[model samples]
Target: MRLSMPWFVRLAVIVVFATGLQAAPAPALAGSDQPPGMIAAVVARVRDSVMRIVVVHPPEAPPGEKTMAKAGEGHPVTRIGSGFVIDPDGLVATNRHVVENATAIFVATPDGGRFRAEIVGMPHKADIALLRIHTGYKLPAIKWGNSDALRPGDTVIAIGSPFGFDNTVTAGIVSSVNRDIMETPFDDYIQTDAAINHGNSGGPLFNINGEVVGMNSVLYAPGTYSGSVGLGFAIPSNDLRFVLSRLEEYGQVRAGMLPFRTQSVTAMMAEAIGSPAPGGALIAALGPRGDEMNGLIQPGDVIRTFNGEVVTDPRDLARKAARAPIGSTVRLGICRSGTIMAVNVPILAYDPHPQPIQEPGPPPKMLGLQFSAAEGSDGTIRGVAVSAIDPTGSAADSGLQTGDIILRVQQQPISTPEQARAALQARAAAKQPYAAVLVERNEKRTWIPVALPGE
Candidate 1:
């Protein structure tokens, strides 16, 4: 017969098992239980100070019509983007493209009040601009977070107008730091996937603590009508702050610029340039003449370092070069003609004169045709020769090619780059949908259609 256990013993065993299970702690909550961190508090404190900007645009003139206004004059145009208040006096920061040609700029606050704003200054090379709004109302201003402290995978929040939706919040992680996708002199961009869009330009990208770390800018994609494909870029707060301080002090951006045009090299191309291994940066060209006459450096030189930063590629060199202060002597480790050497070059302040990034008066919308002035020689083609065409640009789609000299635009003699701009302006005023340019490629001249920006 089995021995019967006492009822008290049985109860004791059950109690011991139950006590062991209860000793295990419940799962901790997702957020810190005590309180939101200082960072979160910081972010919440500045959310309302941001603004959505709306600008009015002027209609384009007709073709063959003398400009009612002089060349390089302003026309009214409508633009929409986002910005954040930076001062109690209503200073705001935004992207240059947002107010590039604004006749009038207005900012609408989250509280539904609107105020007129003035463009304080703009830096074309840096792609940054500053504006001031005199609302006479106290507005919240955001505190800037240090961009140097940012790391990949850090949580970030982007608040902006996406597709005209105001104050939309999208969360994401910092995809990258110090990205140099564009050829801008100052190109330290913060890559994120925070759902940026058409109306998001100039808006702030915040860290979890809500401090502004970057200014949302471009999307990496083709075509005018496209959505974010998880690739969005921002101007780091470090750079934005630098530009802002300079603008407030100098009324323009004053930064160092190298006198050279560079092309990024891949591993394969690095080898072609005679790099010891398949990894390094190369100088593609010196500046377009005047500035290049200084002749401190030459093309085909492999740059190993700049200003103490390791230069892995052309972009790295550009990023470091741009960040160096103007009037400073920058140390460069260069490899030329299979020989390594060190040189110090004085960096110049960024050229403030807006040299047309593209050919001046070239149609706003690029057809992707690049033309150059002809040389002084008989039997040489004259006028605007299509030296290169962008495969993805409108001209490439239209079958334009290299060595093609454009003689006429819309039946107007296109003798020079200035003439080309005038012809395009006239055609645009005429309400002509497109301007036909006469081109000579391979000694055969024919007419090609060029599209204007607003058309």
Candidate 2:
């Protein structure tokens, strides 16, 4: 807990606790009434561990190509950020946004030592990323602190290169903990008034004991001002440790997925369902994403707790589910039909972004009828996707909807919108009455005899 004090008394509060020895008098500040040497001692131990990150973004690639140019792509953009060493062997932690899409990453030390760094871990659920550098010399690593023990009004120190100024230090009290800035699903941030700005994206936020408690990732600035207005947020150290550990072991973190879709309990729904309070996850949908439950669970079951922890709502359960280990059975408290019972549910691995299947033919283009093609990552053309349709148009009248992909027309396979248009134009010249349009919607295919215009 923090002892709220005047601006002038902060240095004294930390200095007194840092150096509790009675043998000698501590050093004093040059011109201030507050005592000194505590902040200096803390920065002295961890500043060398802090690094200036310089990232070179790869050139924009032409459609379906690795990169636009062969070597030395022109107009390479550079981004600067900050990071701190977590392992002596050169494992550095920073925000993923700092080095995202970076072709090459470089790190510089306070002693002018520089080396190329590589991204080791980038988790989808968390904004944190890990980088590794090789160096023969011994490196200074920062000490880890318990973010769970932190509370509002606790003292904190931020170190980073704000606006390209290296080694800038700012001090403030933690405005709050467990602060959800709506950044991520598992957002538990340490909100402080420290002067964090651009270029401080990945710097470390240290506690009064000089231990690294969080990493400065984001800041708030009103209006057109890009500079700090004393509002900064850091990802808690406890959250970072889990991602780091998983990355080191599995090369990626696996988020646990729930079998059933859930909704937040409302006051009216709670009273109707016999729940004492409007808190818990209400199972909204079952049987599609929920087939794994094996009919043991049903819809309308309110999950009151997960693995013995009382859930505040659906979001709380989601956050807890992400942290749970996959392939493990978790005990859930359920309120169903006015009876409270326990149910064991298995956690599954979540695949957030799955690649779409490609069509294995020509490239994509859109012309008349607002048709576009879906292209896969490896240059393979997918089916022609319908982006929009006129409500009064024949396509919409024949059951074609947005997000439906045109698979074939008139019993001919079509890969692109250009192909679909060409085939239809030929069929129109032949004066066909109705075209058997095969379209895929939501992974299901159906034939719709769309009436040809001017027929």
* Every candidate's CA RMSD: 23.7, 21.7
Write the residue-wise lDDT of candidate 2 on 140-233 in tens digits.
Answer: 9999999989887777888987666688887777888877666665667798877677788789999878899999987776665655666788
TM-score of 2: 0.65
Computed on alpha carbons, the lDDT of every model, listed in order, comes to: 0.66, 0.71
Clashing pairs in 2: none
The worst-scoring run of ten residues by lDDT in candidate 1 lies at 8-17
Candidate No. with top TM-score: 2
lDDT of 1 by residue, 266-372 (tens): 77776676666544567777765425335668888877778666777666666566668877888887778778788888777557464432211222354445557
Off by over 4 Å in 1: 1-43, 59-78, 183-185, 220-225, 265-280, 289-296, 352-455
Model 2 scores a C-alpha lDDT of 0.71
